[model samples]
Target chain A: MKTIFTRRFPASVKIIAIVVLSLLLVLSSDSLAPARQYLSTFFSPLQVIASAPLEALDNVSETVKSRETLMAENQKLRQLELSISDRLLKLEHLEQENSRLRAMLGSPVVTTQRKLIARIQSVDTDPFRLQVVLNKGIKDDVFIGQPVVDEHGVVGQVVEVNEFSSRVLLIADNSHAIPLRNQRNDVRLIGLGRGDVHQMELQYVTKNTDVKIGDMLVTSGLGDRFPEGYPVASVTGIENRGNEIYSTIRIRPIAQLDRIRYVLLLWPELATSDASAPEVLSQ
Target chain B: MRRSPFFTFLIIWLSILCAALLQILPLPPLVDEYFRPQWMLLTAMYWALALPNRFGIGSAWIAGLILDVLWGTTLGFNGVMFGLCAAFMVENNHKLRTYSVWHQSLILLGLVLVYQMLFGTLSSWLDDALVTNSYYASSFITLLAWPWIFFTLRKVRRRLFLS
Candidate 1:
């Protein structure tokens, strides 16, 4: 029943100490990257355990899937693959001719992307940040700032790397902004996340800017972080409120941000001396 | 019965882990961060009240640090707030333990308001942490959840052996 404040480890003093320590940790998170790796290594087991139910649900659905639907899907995929392969044959020819032309110009040889498949490990980021944990990490050569993309388009970039898992800040996070160009007219703009999973707003868009509904935006390669020419988002909605200097243009990410399962990690060709580097086929 | 402090240690760590799991459990977006009460803080508050000497500011600080990692908030961010919260609990442990659940809920609401406000503001300033109008939604649910958690945890505490 004694007054707790009078104790040696006084509440006020402890509060100040903790606050200072917490601020220090937050402000210098970059310096604490190694510390975060160790912390996540300890917590990865807990994260793995938490992800078990999700994986189980995935497995159950996979097993309980009706054979008829799967057959239908397989047939659809076969047709799509046939068409894709046909186009791929033409693409290979075009690629060779383009690379040959570039070689004739004495430009640097085209470098093929080294891709590794990774799975989304966790999707429970608080509303404050939009991020997902990838099961691949430092062990998998997931260096920070690596671009992640699904088959459709750009998803996000690696912000924090751990031992066995890394965190990717989604392109839809408010803090995230990507340089993009309109696919139709090649007009350039930056897409900024509005904290929504699918929607991003165009930055620095004047009312007279050449943008319209359904315009596809691709990576402009301005930042050089994300590779050029990847489809990012399409213009979903364009609005001009009265007297507003800038038009409000909403773009939805081409990648399915809501239900992420698997994605490909891109590396600069021969960027790493690891085993996976040499296996990349030149496109 | 004189119970070993190890029992207290076990209870705190076990509950902390459980809270961390629940806090990050992949529920739908709306139900996860908004609907979920401040589990880590609630656990810290309950134990700080039940065992004031054992579960004080230090315990809450550690719980918050873990949550900072788990919640994807700034490191030590939740730690600082939870530590302050634990200080409040330990300082007024006698009064809070004696207060009716209804009254305690009101007090808990005030504490949550502070936590949420500081979280929203600091997270925005510290980094471009997407603070929005919906940030206060979490505080609302945390307020509504206090009475049920207080009673359930009180019952659970009695069942556990503590010195």
Candidate 2:
């Protein structure tokens, strides 16, 4: 009876031993960084393969759209074009006048160069993080720190570069922060990412600051990583608690992350005249 | 009797694909950024609860590693969370086998809470991160999803393992 009990005891011990061994096996994968890198490289091709079907489906749907529907939309757009023409004429005059005024004030002419267009190929598979992968990569001269922007506003900066693709870390990522200044009053503040793709929080603003709910925040050019005068966000709400040293300012990001089709990767030219420009610029 | 291991593997791969799709789908404005549904977690939870003999802690850890790479998070955060959760479920398999739907749900909810706390604490310690209450909001959603996932998986198992 003692021998039989001892044998059964070893059987239970074996079960526990197996469970512990399996647990160690599970935990070991986390420590193997090389395995992850290898898996990403291995899985990237599969991602590209999977996304291709959706892209093709999108193309086919667009192609198969009825011409009658297109004609009506084109006619409506033509009417809109006629109405906006006068505004464009006035806008051109205003732009020239503004440049002239800036020249008179001896402000350096802000010229942007080195624009490379890239299509968004993928989005990060992590729900909590906001990141996008672009088709442009080192092959297209895209670098890790390149600034990606749309016509409307700044989008994000390239965080990782692959052979044929690069990943953009949006301003709403928890790790991203940008130096911003109010476009109206030029008061400087640090726009910290709230980890939400739609919102950023402004920090270090004194209670006496002139920031209002509708104030526009633009890149201050203090951070060399991002260019100056790019629209970052607009203040959506502000509260100056009577006793607090600083006001709490919340901003809504201007970029339409979902609507992005094409983005310009701004690769600064080292040979440019303003390449050595001072980091500090008044908002 | 032989288990259809190949079919099980294929289903896992399909689930991973679905999880990745769920991760990328844009949410509405009211959804908190930190509170997005953890598809990988749900899938891992399902596998561990249903098929401990096949999908064990080792499988969960591998899936978590993929998540870490895709998200660019601190490397092992999701991995450790996933592994621990799977092991917890596996150890309780015999007890879980006899549980009713409601009881299973409560267990899963507790497991989800534990997973979230593990990830949250690790995040705060590593990066001085501050997250809102939205992070835990997914637990309710996951509980609602658990029964559906369980039933669907059971159907799949019957179809695949049928002699």
- Candidates' lDDT values, in order? 0.80, 0.70
Which residues of candidate 2, in runs, are more than 4 Å off? A1-38, A45-61, A64-112, A121-125, A135-139, A163-165, A184-187, A196-198, A207-215, A235-238, A257-261, A271-283, B1-39, B49-54, B124-130, B154-163
TM-score of 1: 0.90
Docking class of 2: acceptable
Model 2 chain A: lowest-lDDT 10 consecutive positions:
A1-10
lDDT of 1 by residue, A1-283 (tens): 2334546766778888888888788889888878877887788777788888989999999999999999999999999999998998897676666656766777533233577889888646655888898888888888989999988999999988888888888899989999998999999999999888878999989999999899999998777688777899999898899998999899999999888888888875422212221243221
Model 1 segments more than 4 A misplaced? A1-6, A103-112, A240-246, A270-283
Give the Å error, residue B112, model 1.
1.7
